[model samples]
Each structure stands twice: as C-alpha cells, then as structure tokens.
Target: MSKVYILMGVSGVGKTTLGMMLAEELSVPFYDADNFHSASNKEKMQNGIPLTDLDREGWLGKMSSLIPEWQSSNGGVLACSALKEKYRNQLAGGIDKDLEWIFLFEDFSIIADRISKRKLHFFNPDLLKSQYDTLEPPDYGIHIKVENSPEESLKEILQKLNMPEFGIIGLGVMGKSLALNMAGKNFLVSVYNRREGELEENIAQNFVDKYSDKYQLQGFDDLKNFVFSLKSPKKILLMIKAGDPIDEIIEELIPFLKTGDLILDGGNSHFKDTERRLEKLSELGIHFLGVGISGGEDGALNGPSIMPGGSKEGYNRVKDLLGSIAAKDRLERPCCNYIGPGSSGHYVKMVHNGIEYGEMQLIAEFYYFMRYFQDRSPEAISKVFTEWNLKQISFLLEITADILLKKENNQYLLDKVLDIAGQKGTGGWTTVAALEVGVSLDTITASVFARNISAFKKHKNQVRELYKLKNKADLEITDDELFKSYRSASVINHSIGFELLRIASVEYGWNLNFSEIARIWTNGCIIRSSFMEKLSGIYDSTKSSHLLLYPDIAEKLNEDQEIFTRIIPAILSQGCPMQVCSSALNYFLSFTRENTPANLIQAQRDYFGAHTYERIDKPRGEYFHSNWKPE
Candidate 1:
C-alpha cells in the first residue's frame, strides 16, 4: 500500500474507525488529525464552540506536511474532517488525484446520535450542526455510505485499493478485451470461458497464452477455480449474453460465491430481468449490478461509457476499477457513474440504442438522397459524409463515411451489401417501453419500423416491379439546407428518446441526472459527438426534463423548422422513404403547435359512442358527451 488514504467526512461518521481498520489490514501507520489539534482548539470544542477556518488552518497544514513523509515510508491512512473543498485541497498539497479520498456520508441524525454516545471526545456534540454546515462534499473521490458496518466499509476500501483483483466469467470479444484492459491498468485479472466439450479449445487459456506475457492475467477453465481465485468480496463481471444465459450462469456460480460477493452483468439485459435478478441475489446476500457497457468491441478494448445500477454498495466497491477502464468526457472525467438503482442502467442503455437506431436511419436517409436521388458516386458520397462529419461530429456519421469509402474489386462494398438491417431488440424494447409509459417515441419507432421494412426485401422487390416507382429527377438541394434538415431531425430524435427517459424516470422513481447521462454519452458510446457535448451543458443550464422546451433549444428548432419541413417532403417526392425524418418532422409539428385536429377526433368519438370530450370553452379536465344520432 504505497498510496495515501484519507477518510474524509463530518465528525462521528466512523472515519477514524475505518481508517484504523484499513491501516491494520494493510499493515500501515494510521494518523488521526485530532491528535495534532492545538490545546486551545480542543478546549473550545469541549466547551461546545465550533472552530473557525482560521483556527484549523495550522492543523491542516501540519497534516499536509506529513503526507510526503508517510508516502515515502510504506504508506499511511489519515482520518481527517476534510469537509470543505479548500480543506481537502490543502491536505492534498495539489496532488489531489494521487491521494484516495473515501467520503463516509450518513444521515445527520445518525452522526448526531453517534457523537452523543461518545464518552470522552473533545468535540462537542452540539457543534455537529456547524460541522455539517461547513461541509462541502466533493463530486470526485470514492463515496461510501456510512450505514453499513465498519467491516463492510473497510472491505470496500480495500477491494478498491487492490487493483486488478477482478474476474471475468466469459472470454468473448468484450470479455477478453475488457480483461486485457483491466490487466493493462495493473489489475490482477482472472478470466474463465466455459468449455462446452472435452475437445473444445480453452478460450480463456488461449487468451492467457497470447497476452499473459504482457499483462498480469490468468485463465481458468474450471468455474470453481475462477470464483475462488478472486480476492474476498469477489468482483466478477459477466460479459455473456443477456436473458436466459445470464440466469444460467448465475445459478451455476451461486454455489461458489459467498455472502458478500459482487456480480456485474455487463450485457444489454432487459431492465425487468435485471430487476428480478437483483431481488433474487439480494435474498441470497449476493450483490448484483446491471452494468450497461456501450461502444462495441473497440470501445470495450479501449474505453466506453459504463452505466451501473443496483446495489450502490457493490458499485462503490468496483467504482475505481470501472473508472480506470472507462472513457473520459471533455473535462477528463470518467464516463462512468451509478445510474440510480434497480436496472436503470439497462433502461438507459436501451434508450441509447434507440437513439442510435434513429441517428443511423437519419444518416442513411442523407446518404440515400446523395447516392440515389442526386446520383453521386460512392467516392463523392464519402466526401459529402466527410464534410458532414466535420460539422455534425458523431460516431455514426464518421462510420458512414468509412463505409462509403470502403471498396473491393473497383466497386463500393456498401453497394454490394444487403439492404436489410438487423436489430437485437433493444430498439424495439425502447419503443415498447415508451408505449407502456405513455411517452411519444415517434422517431425511434419509425427507425425500428424502417429496419423492419428493410427486412421485407423480397416483398419490396415485388412491389417495386408492380409500381415501377422511379426517383424523381432534377430534385436537388444545397448542402447547407440538407445539413440543417438533418441536424433538425437529429435534435428531434434525441428529444423523443430523452422525453421517454424523463417519463420513465418518474414512473420508476429513478431520479436520473439528465446532465450526467448527456455527459457520459459525449464520448465512447455510439452516439458520441459535439452535439452531445452541447446537450450536456443544455441539461445542466436549463435543469428541465423536457429538452424540447429549453428556451434556446426551442428557439433553434423554430429557426430550423422551415427547412426541415420543406426537405422531408422534397425527399419523399424523390421516392426516398425518409421514415425517421418524416416522423421527426411530425413529432415536432405535433409538439410545438398550440392546437390540433385531435379535437375533431374527440368529437367523432363522443358522437359515435357517447365517449367524453374536454370542452375548449370550459376549464381543462371537464368532460362532456355528445350524441349525433339523438337529434
């Protein structure tokens, strides 16, 4: 243990006890900041007086000076009331990232109760209010709730400190890559891939043979050995398939895992399935985390946005490890956070995939206009995408450019590839969830429908032969107009997805931080872009769940609507489907308008079936029935 550990919190939050326990576990020296307090300061605190900042300056400086000495000597743990940001900075001596700050937070009444129970402590229990008032919790650092036992807290701290002590149950693309990533970060990584047959090559062992020389990696074919190899409070990440496979693996591992062991499902499991597994594991005293990892195989190897929900205690234990392997946002913060509890991670990931589908379809519509309607060659279309990528800056846009550029045998490979698109159910799940929650996801639903229609290639070919549909000639638009239209549609696409997230957050009591979600999606994920970066700021500044209602956003939409409205119909005139674009335009039109034809629909319903309709002349929520045949 060569690192310095600072347990920072208000008084009577078990900092000293945890610090001493951690120090003993690591065989290091433990220093209590109270031991260095001046006699007068202690006397004032004993008389129920709170010490001012000026009074604690010297004590903090003394503790700061001892940091280098302790670091030089093996290591050390210090329990200090580093409540304020300035106090922690002073103690860190500008080396903030080097020292691990474990913030022990609990309810105010709990701290007050513990302080009242103190027999001979110099600090006054009455000064607890002043202490809490002075406290400014840092956003950084490892946060550990003080509700758990000291032993449990110590276990979390030690597990976080011990790098590379992680196990991966599956050595598939993501599993192997992530294992290497963790090992590359100096984690002791244990990997196991189940061998289905006696003659089957050991995937885990093969992985070790290839990369173990460069990294601290071990492979196990035996399930029990892999589970036993990890340190206590075993942190195992399962990168297997979602649904039944996840449940099967859990049941197999249940016998080997202990009471406090942690399991992280790093797959796109359904939120409901994750919730059920969480409840089941809680009954067995096993912690389960639904971890949504995005950015494909490459992102998994390098970095990706990680969303983990369920068992906050389990999350805290592995936060350091995940943060080490996750991508960085513009400010260089790790793109990983505990996204509330009970399967919210999977829910967010599902919406992210839905957004991805919409974005991909929008980009495809742009390509279709350029290639088919404008009759541009692949090289020319690739150039167009290159320019668009400069302005739009998204993973899908960048990859679309690459796909257009790829050629084999003097022909574009994209042209030879099948027109049908395949989906893995996440996008459909998102649409179904929106329907269940009464949220409109028109653009995402259209994207999913676009894919579904693409799958009917044979039927479409027959229909094309019967109708002889031809793309209209001489249909052209300026690049600037096209870009504006695409940008408008993209904005609407995200608006619908986030609106669903907002409604679902309320329905499920997730209390999601929209800004944090945007921040994390700004990098690594499939939808990463400068646009997402702008969105993160918008979410923070507006502090509103409905993104379309943000003043600046609404103003921009108002400006862009003219072109967006004209271009979709123009593309449709040229025989391009542009379903997502059309859906986006309709969604925006329906949402922004003050009145709609739905009033007539309500009248028709009331006339036919005596169903109720709200009166426009009366207050809202007042219902009236009409009968057309009663005359």
Candidate 2:
C-alpha cells in the first residue's frame, strides 16, 4: 500500500534536499512547506526574529490541509520543519493514518557549517539557534543521522520507514498467540483488532502495551492505520472467525489496500468458500491464501502445523517467517509448508479434523467400554489409557489419559461433564467432501454420526426409560485386546482420510504430497503420533494412493485383523455402540473382499430405473439392463 511520507527536521538538517531525492526515487511529487510560509513569518526569520506559535498557526493549518489532497493522487513527499509537537499533530491531522515521518538530524557544528554556505536563502543564519530551541524531536517517526553520505541517509530512511514486515488482524486467542509467535522470531509485526466488542475495547493497544518493550511489535485499532503500517505488497493474516465475518473484514480492509498485497485466511473456513474468495481476490490483484492452522491455542503460541495454499509467489513471500514460527519435525524441518493450489490447505485440514473425530470417538468408546461394560472406575480407565499411550503414542491418547485423571471436589471431573459432544463443522465438511469425491469415508462418517446421535439427549433418555439396557460386567476383555481394537480402528480411520485426500487431490489437481502432509503432522497437530511418524516414512518409501495398500501397513493390518474379528462381535453383543470400530471393520472387510452384495444392488437399480449393471462374463465396460417381471 502507498502512504504520504513527511520529512521533518530543523532548517539545516537537509530535509528539503533528501525529500526531493526520495520523491524522485519513489517516483512521486515533492512539496516544500517553506514555500507555503507567510510573507510576514519569512520576513521576521530574515531579520533574526523568532515567530511565535500564534504566528505559525495559519501556516501549519494550510500545510495540514494539503496532506490529504497530495495523498489522494499517488502518494507525495513533503519537507517541513515541524519542530513542535502541536505543529506535527496539525500536519498529521488532515490525513492522520497514512502518513510516515522521517526525521533527519546531525551535530550542531555540522548543521551550522552547512548553513553558513547558503547565500540566496531568505532566512538569516542568525535565526538557526532559535529553530533548534523550538524543535521537539518525536520519538516515534523514523530517525536518520544526516552526518552520513546523502545516499546512505536516504537508504537508512527507506529501511526504517518499512516499519513492520508482518501484519496480523484480529487478536483473539489464536490470533494473539500467533502474533507473539511471529514476534518471538524477531520479525517486526503490526497487530490490529477492531475495538467493537466489549472485550475488544483496547485489545491491540493492550497487547502492544504488555509486550512492546520485549519485542518489535506495534498495535493499531484503526484499520487504515494498520493497513498503512505494513510495507509494500503487504502480507496480512486474518485470524478471525470464518464465514461472512471474514468477508466483511476483507471488504472493509480492501479500500485501504493496493494491488499485490496478500491476505491469508487462517480460520477453519470451508474449502469451497476459500476457493470462491481466492478467485474473487485474484481478479482484484490481491493474493488470497487459505492457510490451515492446527494444534490449538498452546500450539499457536509455541509452534503449530501450518498449511498454506495459494499463489506460489505469495507463499514464497511469507514462507520464511512462517517456517521460523512453525513446529519442527524429528529431522528439524518446519511443519509449515505450501500445501497445494486452490483451497487444498483447508481441504487437507478438514480431512485432518475428520480423522481426529474418528480417533476421538474410538477413544471415547474405549472409555465407555471400560467404565460401563467392564465396571472399571475413571481412575482405572485413566491408567489404561496411560498404559496404552506408552504402546502407541498419540496426542489424542495422551490428552485422553490426562483428561480422565482430572478431578474436581475429589471426584473424577469426567463424571461431571456432559456426554454430548460439540463439532465445529470441519468434520462434516470432510464427510461432504468425501461424498463429492466418491470416497467411502465410513470410519470418519461414523464418528460424525456418533456425535449427532449424542446430541439427541432427550430422545435417548426416553429410550433409556422405555427399554432396559444390558450391562456387560461379565464380559472381560484384556487391556491388550482393547488396545489392539483401538489401534485397528484408528488405522482404518487414518486410511479413509488419506484415501479421501488422494482422490480429492486428483479431482482438484492439487497434486498433494502425502509424505509432506504426514511429516508436518508428526509433531504439531492434534493427531500427531508415533504412528504418523512411521506413516511419514512409509509414504516416503512407498507409492500408493491407499495407505492400506502399502506392504508394511498391510502386514500390520493382517496382524491386527484377528483381534477385530473377535472383539467386534463381543462388544456388540453387550448393546454397546461401537460405531467407529464396527464401521472400520466393515470397511476393511469390504475392501478386502473379492466380491460384494453391491452387484445385487446394481441389478435392483437396473430392474427398476434402467441404471444398467455390468456383466461379469463379458468385458469390463459391457453393461446390460434387466426386466425382472417381463423377463
């Protein structure tokens, strides 16, 4: 974005000379406030008389009014001796937000020596001391020492004027934490949050107030000031809520921005919406990136898995700073990467959440089996999960173990919590995307349904009173057996999610790198686990669209398949709903089977609606319709 730059200093500080040079280099118009001075004021300075603030009021007002007019027509450079605080404020009053000031100064002797050589100027050399006494140097604007070469001084001015390298809009938990993360990496950061909500009265100002002394961070409440604070081709990350709010913010922010500025949507936005926004912004010469951020608040503060997708050049511009703030893999590579073109970053993140839903549901089922069917206490279940975590380390399992151990008033906190689970729509998005891509995501889909079923609390209570449910205390399954079942379900869950990505990658021309996605997930995501670390290596070595088709993974599945065969029926016999596990087993069985009852369904379709079925005895592409009754 463009801005009006003001060059301010004492008379002999070379403001006019440097301002002219900078205007030429920037290809903008230049103005000298000295030429706008009143004839009476100049005459007093010429006769060694100092002008009072009263004498300068009209002069400052006229110069201030010219700022907005100059800024409206491509930005302009103005040289002025705005020696007093009030005078500087007056000059900024016309266009308060988009003005950047550069202050040039030097030793008194050097300035005096330079002033002595001037002959044609109207101002008398005797008045130079009065100008110095009237000066009130600002602490905020870019300050450059003019004792250096003019070229060096100009270079310093330009460098210092590019105040902030990164800008973050919204200062919510995730946004606030992420801004700190970027600032921790030594990147100059500009943070903005609208002062509308009750809690947002001074959010950005408060953030800068708390941390500015420790880091190079500036905060702004005004959108225009925030937008203008960033350097050219601004890189901004929007960490606000997704949906219409994001679009509204973009609309409000666009007027202050210019072409080539990049905006990244870092919320859990629907990929279709991301695709639409990307196309719209591209037409306006503004680059839009759909970035998927995971690992929650703590991860955002420390290091999270960052998935960014958009224009290649746009990614390149912010990749370094993002990489510096992202979590590192075992080999010390950042978890952040350019995911793919279009909305693939959000797409991958949606699938990631789908797999998370499945894994969480399966873990919850494990807890239910132990607490209800096996009559184990919450403390005992915590121990079971802790032991299981040692065997198959995962973020979900680790947290589950921790959650079960939490107590309030000497009672297990898990007992007091409601059973109904909440979803944030990404899992549903994954299910919908799976259907659109023709991928059977039964494991993840079952998880989404399980949450929906939990939400029908009233109906469930009515059914509970109507029918007596069986308690399977007599049914004993060893921890080893339960872990095996859980692991088996999780494997299928991940496989289905990856298969969706594989198909969608082809459908959308994303050409996604499965290994890189897995690699990034190894450390900083909710699903991070030793299994993902292994899967990363598996994808690096094997070339397969389906994770189950990899020889190593298939061998592991073969070893684990026997436990599912026994446990699935046993668990279902107790009236326990093992949706994720049973769905996974059914999916596995169908995928492995050479033939299925789908042929009968196809025949039924053909008999009823003329949706023809292929003939097994004929070539693969040959199809035939059937007439059931007439034939």
Q: How far off is residue 370 in model 2, in Å?
A: 0.5
Rate residue 250 of model 2 by lDDT.
92
TM-score for candidate 2, please give it: 0.77
Measured against the true structure, the TM-scores of the candidates, in listed sequence, are: 0.78, 0.77
Off by over 4 Å in 1: 4-164, 198-200
What Cα-based lDDT does every candidate model obtain?
A: 0.87, 0.88
1-631, model 1: which lDDT tens digit per residue? 2688899999999988998998998898999999999999999999998888899899999988989888877778899989998999888886533477788899999999999999978888999998888999875456788888999988877765554368998878888888877888888898988788865468888889999569888788998988767766678999998889999999999998877789999999999999999999999989999999998889898998999999998897789889999999978999999998899999999999999999999999888888888888878888877898898788888888899989899888887999999899999999999999999999999999999989887787689778966675466698888888999999999999889988998899988888899999998899999889888888863256688988878888888888889988988876778999999999988998899999899889988788899986999999998665655
Expressed as tens digits, the lDDT of each residue in 1-631 for candidate 2 is 3578889988888988899999998999999999999999999888888888888899989988878778778889999989988899877873445577788888777898899999889878787888888888875557788988888899888776758978999998999999999889877899999878786787898999999778889899999999878876688999999999899999998887767789999999999999999999999888889999999998998999999988776887688788989999999999989999999999999999999999999999889988889888887998999999898899998999899889899998888989899888998989999989899999999999999989998897689889998987557788888988888888989999999988998899998998989999998889999999888888852355688888988888899889877897799888988999999999999999999999889988988899998988899998887787764
lDDT of 2: 0.88
Output the number of the TM-score-best candidate. Answer: 1
Measured with C-alpha atoms, the lDDT of residue 35 in candidate 2 is 92
